[model samples]
Target chain A: MTQTSLTLCCKVLCVESDDDKPLASPADSLALIAQERANLERDLTPDPRWMFWPWGFAWLLGFGLFFLRFGPDGRVFVDLPEWLPLTVLSLSFIAAGLITGIAGGRSAMQTRGPSSRQGLMYGLTWSIAFTGMGILFAQYGDALPDDRLGLLWAGGMVALTGALHMAGGAIWNDRQLFILGAWTSVINVAGILVGPGWHSLIVALGGGLGMILAGLLGWLRLR
Target chain B: MSDGTELDPVIHAQARLRVVSALSVLREEDKVTFPRLQESLRMTAGNLSVHLRKLEDAGYVEVTKTHQGRTPATFVRLTRRGRLAFEEYQEALRALLNPTSPSTSSEETL
Candidate 1:
């Protein structure tokens, strides 16, 4: 009836394996059950190493390039053409997106039911959310002062990215993803407060590098 | 020694229990490939095949030989009955651990 009495019961009910090896106490047996479950979860879940790094490098190179072309107060650190930085940034994200999509699709290839469906639905959410954000930005682009235009575009995208990452983390119970999102959101705000060019530097160093670090941790864990 | 209830013999063995517990983590409809199951359990193919055969015969698991692309593969999943039996086995284990554990209290209340 009490904990002590229950432990006595456990001692008596020791499960013996085929070779007559006495299993431990009932509490220990329960612990083993938990251990097995944990082991299975580790083996069964999709690996995140493939997803994190691509996005990390995308931000690192993309925003790093942007910082070079769009330094504060109309001071261009690198005299690269206006089209070059944005083009390179866009290409980087496109490449990352493709990598993410392919990796996700391959992982889900054999899986069906809600898990696979959730992956597809979540992927759509990212694309649709960005498209909607882009559309709204275009409609309101002319209303902002010419100088503030860049801040809205660059800072706004980073914020949206952070918010989405947090949302994904919430759904999946992924602490790393959520923290990265929060980190991105914070740096995005820091970038905007400092005005143009500086925003690129902050996001490039803060969000981009943070992602690479998280991805590195994930890679280490996989290994 | 048990408190009148016994664990299902089919799952009492350590190797089979490991297999069942691992498969139990997935949704009832979800299945694990034979290689994947073997990998997770770290059991040799022959040994796993024997245990799985026992489970299949007991109606606790279903084993299917199928093709993924051109390669031959086997998949396994717990049947609904098997899942229920596993739950009962866990309850039986708890009962053995403590005859008066809280799980029995609801029915024992008089």
Candidate 2:
């Protein structure tokens, strides 16, 4: 139907509440059903988390880690100690975690469908899987070359993140998130094939751009 | 004649039907705020209040008025009775729409 017609139908449907009025014609009933379905679709759309503060910090974390790993011309840009980047990365994660926890807690209090506990479970699972992978890599570090080790780490992180996103998206039935997860998964495989030297760059450019774009889209939607 | 008559008049009205339909999709404990419901239904505050009062009077919906800091917020959720009434209304509507169908007779027996 034309937008004008739909709006007129919706307006009619919204205004008619009198019990004394004649029963709605089949066409009118159909229109009301259509309008109701549209409203439900609009309402059930998930909150725009990409616009949240933690997401912005997540982008920073990706870029910061990339810069730390590659460095500028083999020299640190800020000439900081080797441990400083790790410290910064850890701090960013803590900040993101805190923000997510606060936001999720507030959201859970307001809405009953999306449970904060479910989100915490997802996060805990990811952390455990990541730590297990790290231990395995450490144990096999001597068997692999230094360059290949970096590739494995980067690829593993990307794959893990993509898998989690895909899982969450599937559970929530969010198409945007599912597509993002698929895009990241594709990029992860492609980055690994390029080998170590360029893997970080690919991830930084691809993943960072993806996140920024998603954030911008979410912001626009909110506006 | 009884087919259409079986429908719940409280839910059969378009505005109230929309309200109950929206609330039905939400989790049982979830509450929709007044502004959100108004926007979704594209109705004026006064008009929504009237319909909400009717539903509240019928014991189909529970309306809560509370303060968020300095601002007052109105939240609404369907009661269990409300959900059941909505389901029965839907069944009656289907029967009315398909009076000649065998399935309608089977549904009516249930």
Taken over the whole model, the C-alpha lDDT of each candidate is 0.76, 0.65
Error of 1 at A215 (Å): 3.3
**How accurate locally is residue B32 in candidate 2, as Cα lDDT from 0 to 100?**
69
How many clashing residue pairs, candidate 2? 0
Candidate 2 positional error at B1, Å: 14
lDDT of 1 at A155: 84
lDDT of 1 at B89: 64
What TM-score does the first chain of candidate 1 have? 0.79
Off by over 4 Å in 1: A1-35, A79-84, A131-150, A216-223, B1-6, B44-49, B57-59, B62-75, B79-81, B84-110
Off by over 4 Å in 2: A1-23, A44-157, A173-183, A186-190, A197-223, B1-6, B100-102, B108-110
Clashes of 1: 0
- Please write out the lDDT profile of model 1 over residues B1-110, one tens digit for every residue: 35222346687677777778888887767777788778878889999999999999999999988887899878888889889877866765676567676766643452
Cα lDDT for residue A223, candidate 1: 46
Provide the TM-score of chain B versus the true chain B for each model in turn: 0.87, 0.85
TM-score of chain A of each: 0.79, 0.63
**TM-score of predicted model 2?**
0.59
